[model samples]
Target: MTDRVLYLVVCGAPLAKRVGDGVRAARESGWSPYLIPTDAALPWLETQDLEGAPVLTANRKPGAPKRAPVADAVAVVPTTFNTLNAWANGNAGTYPLTTLCAALGARTPTVAVPFAKHDLAGHPAWLASLAVLRYAGVRVVNPHDGSSTALAPVASGTGEEVAKRFQWSWVLNQLQEAGA
Candidate 1:
């Protein structure tokens, strides 16, 4: 296994369909990536190869051994409106949320690529949540590029088109620069 461990957390969004590409890219970059998909993301993952990376959907049973190695970094690709708001509000209602909250609490080097549409991004809570996460040391990158600048919301009915051109390198570069 690689010395670098990455928790590749995925949410249900059009971008999720390309998650296998992310996993392969992580491996190619020498990171041992583990998949942590929200329940909504399951359908998209059905066809992903995962490159043998372990998929952790739920917490281990009490007293059970750990599911994967400690994460050296985290990449929350396709961070949906629901997941973003919930995580920023510190809601650990789901396993993915619990993982995100714990990572924040531990100050793990984290990156989030929001994939919400313009309509959802118009909500006050959307920007507020991104601000909260940024204040807490998470690197919020634009889904279109790796820029740390303010993200532009995806246009309606164009999520799949956006996903098609999304590059895994954007997220990987952020983690590398973070020294993860």
Candidate 2:
């Protein structure tokens, strides 16, 4: 079986924090972690002192050899509406977009956790982009209240709740399905 790595991509500030929290949770859950930030997030990533973790800049070309390290299951946590739309339409003009397109084309499983406000969440464009993503075989998990769930804390009673509900079992299940 192929080894699985968890690729967490961050876009915005709020989502960046959630991604950090998710990374912490994933590490605590005993999974390997690989973090990459889009150009928009590079400054923030550098400020956090992520240590020696591989950091890919957003300015790099999308299909470069360096991006081959991306794993099977990628979680675009707190995906901005713009990024979601771009990926759905095959617009790999940015770093995150290029990485996501490459992974999807490689038949890698992708999970998107959108983080938009209620008003923006219900926008027609957002809904349309979601449909495109689903049609493209991307797993789109939204917040239960029809809002962006990834922006909220995991409903679990533990104070250590992540923005999204990523159970260890669920992750393992997907990995198994991917033959990892």
User: What's model 2's TM-score?
Assistant: 0.69
Q: Per-residue CA lDDT of candidate 1, range 1-180, in tens?
A: 567999989999999999999988998899988999999999999987877878999978999999887889999998999999999999999989999999999999999999998999999999899999999999988887667877989999988988998998989888877788
Q: How accurate locally is residue 148 in candidate 1, as Cα lDDT from 0 to 100?
A: 86
TM of each candidate vs. truth: 0.97, 0.69
Q: C-alpha displacement of 26 in model 1, angstroms? A: 0.4
Q: Candidate 1 — which pairs collide?
A: none
lDDT, model 2? 0.61
Best by TM-score: 1
Which ranges in model 1 have alpha carbons more than 4 Å from their true place?
none
**Whose lDDT is greatest here?**
1
